[model samples]
Target: MSRHIAGDMQRYNVRPNCISPFAWSRMVGAIPTDTPEQQARVEKLKKLGTKQIAPLASDAAADVTAQIFAVHGNEIFLMGQSRPIRGMHTSAGWTLETIAGRVLPAMKQNLYPLESSNIVFS
Candidate 1:
């Protein structure tokens, strides 16, 4: 539930909003299939990302390349550094267990009224 900006685009100063994470909705660089553990897991999965978020891409490339998808409850957020990122809000409260186990981690920093740069929302 965080909207952060890091890795793959280390040239920028934006931090991954894991405190709120933002990343490419599509693939940007070579998909890191470096470790056996990662390859084993990727070998079985089809789509790299979720249905809601847009695939992340790299500016250094010509067109949309690989996709890096994200899943956040009912929706997904796309990763485009040049543009503003967005996320959907929950409609109801949840159980304490759910909050402790699930909800709190995804709780996003207020990203509204996109004027401020500290929390460049998505």
Candidate 2:
């Protein structure tokens, strides 16, 4: 079963870390700068889908810093260095309704609920 799942997950390209704090805006390099409301847009998209998502383009980096991890039935752990948040579960991926369905679990347990989780980027 593990081998089978590994095969299924192998096709998904594992992107290295690109997420950074907002202070690193000057480090965008070749990628275009974010709009003034990028944070708010990210927050809005957080409600729509994708918080800890893979970068948009090959050159694109510096998406939102917030991320979801861990698992417990229908819950995703919103692991924050500053604060711990949780999300309601879904088929998979970030969605407000799914995030909104959070069923908070015990503290300091770094994990989230998913059917088959591979590489998680936070």
Candidate 3:
């Protein structure tokens, strides 16, 4: 969406960028810490304040567009744009068994863990 907006509005000199900011706000404070992992994640988040995200929204960042920035604490990370990381092709197409036996195992290394944003970024 940011890429589309940035392209469409480029002629008008509008640059669209996205910021994924994490801060210990009321919303975060309400997260259930039922497990040890959750408790640890919450503890880490507590160290980040809303102020850490201000710089990315400032005039200094006007030149940056169609980019996703992850803000944590005093750190600002320019995240990679979405794109295919792996691919598989076959002239025979694929059957359920083939996919399960071939594709799954081949692609397993590239799969991302089922973790929350807090855990992933941290």
Candidate closest to the true structure, highest TM-score? 3
Residues 35-86, model 2: lDDT tens digits:
6555543442234333333333234533422233333223345444434364
- Runs of candidate 2 exceeding 4 Å displacement: 1-68, 82-122
Candidate 3 vs. true structure, TM-score = 0.66
* TM-score (all chains, Cα) for each model: 0.20, 0.15, 0.66
Q: Give Cα-based local distance difference scores for all models.
A: 0.39, 0.37, 0.83
Residue 106 accuracy (lDDT) in model 3: 100
Clash pairs for candidate 2: 70-111, 70-112, 70-113, 71-111, 71-112, 71-113, 88-98, 88-99, 88-101, 88-102
Best of the two (1, 2) by TM-score: 1
The digit string of per-residue lDDT tens for model 1 on 64-107 reads 32233334434454444334454334567667776666655655
Greater-lDDT candidate between 1 and 3: 3
Give a tens-digit lDDT track for model 3, residues 1-122.
35778989988878778888787888899989999988988998898887867767787877877988888888888888887799998899999999999999999999978877864664
Distance from true location, Cα of 42 in model 3, Å: 1.2
RMSD of each: 15.6, 15.9, 3.9
**Residue 98's C-alpha lDDT in candidate 3?**
90
